[model samples]
Target: MNESIAIAWPTDDELRAVGETKVLFGHQSVGADILDGVARVYAGASVAAPVIADVSSGEDAPDGTLMHACLGVNGEPLSKFAAFAEMLDTPVAEGVDVALMKLCYVDITASTDVQAVFDAYTSMMADLEAAHPDVRFLYTTVPLTADRGWKSKVRALLGGDDRMGPADNVARERYNTMVREKYAASGRLVDIAAVESAGTDERSQDGHTYHVLNQSLTLDRGHLNEAGSEAVAAELLKTVATYSPVA
Candidate 1:
């Protein structure tokens, strides 16, 4: 049987270095906020004892064995983003053997442009493949949610209001649609939107949204509670089992 390795990289080159079966959890909030959700996503699935690993700052690296779900304990989003951006600007390196790219994030609604996001993602994958012919790429679509306040929080953090507008919601939906279409175009990619959407509905029915922090759902909601995270993790595990050969 072929061994499956998941390389959680912040950039395309670093991703390429690890070679295939790469799960790219793109730019979403990290820290304890999503730890449970991440775990659930990985644990709920049917993997053939697949290894879970992460590439974060020195402080955040997982202490367990390589095959035991490697978690980047101290990786900062800003740093990862900067590194990814830099690699996009430079040339890809050689001898990188990555297969799939899996991305896990909380907010992918109608407010973000789905096409543009996937285009950017696919373009990077294309570049890496151009440099190394043996590599294959797979990316997960941004999950769908009804949290309209997510945009506001992002905007406020950037010096704007704490309320999201209709346009923001529309953009997020568009982004989600784009992901669905793009992943459909490539047989290797995984469409996580279905599971995420279902999970979001479950959260709403429970009289809570996913972005509950400190026992209170924030106004600019874009986080997940323990229950919600568990749901996501279960869905993710299913996705992995379906796509990964090791499973």
Candidate 2:
């Protein structure tokens, strides 16, 4: 990563004028690689964009060009939409030209009300648009857990019956479906459910489990390793490229 990446906050006027082509990223534990890949590609293209990592491990440095908020492990954007409005209100520097905004990992299956989650997300985006009109919102889907055993363990830890139970699968499907439908309803929302679903299926077919992190990918069962992240990044890049102004 280059140390000279640019950073500026969009003005109220500028935010309102932002087009549909900017790149913003909202990510989770394993999805950082996807954001990194997007940054690499955009840098290669000489596109002046910013990648904001909402969750931080504190290992990242502020290059002054790109803004890195090291909000720590517990600082992830809340699962509820209303909380997101408060999250976005946290101040970044002025003149930050954000062309795209991504909200990753709003796992509807994990929430009590899938529709309410979707509605809250929609409302949050609407609030962002009102605050920063220049930035577009891209919502990514929750990836499938490749490790059934690990998932079962997690479920057990949470007092769930079984990770592969019919109810659990149904919830997952319903959440993904709602995400697809919501994205389809608005131009501002970009759906990456197909990509995630396909990637998980491919990995399963190949009998590969675990997520990629750093240079060494792991199969710990919760998040993706670096390899898995890169795969996801590639998929998201392909999606973003479709709307990329430079492309």
Give lDDT for model 2: 0.43
lDDT of 2 by residue, 1-247 (tens): 1011122222222222222333334444545555565454444443454434343232332322333332223223344344344445544423333323333332433333656655665676667779875444456554444335565767777887433333333444566666667675655344443433432322222232222111122244334454444455555544444444433
Model 2 worst lDDT window (10 residues): 1-10
How well does candidate 2 score on lDDT at residue 71? 25
Minimal lDDT window, size 10, model 1: 65-74
Query: What does candidate 2 score on TM?
Result: 0.57
Q: Please give the lDDT score at residue 192 for candidate 2.
A: 42
Q: Write the per-residue lDDT of candidate 1 for residues 1-247, one digit (tens) a residue.
A: 1122232212322222222333333334422333455544445434222234443331222222111122221222223333443432332312222233333343333343445555666676667557556533445554333343565557857866432333343444455566656566665555544443442222322232232122122212345555544444444434433443322
Each prediction's whole-model lDDT (CA)? 0.38, 0.43
Give the lDDT of residue 236 in candidate 1.
44
lDDT at position 139, candidate 2: 63
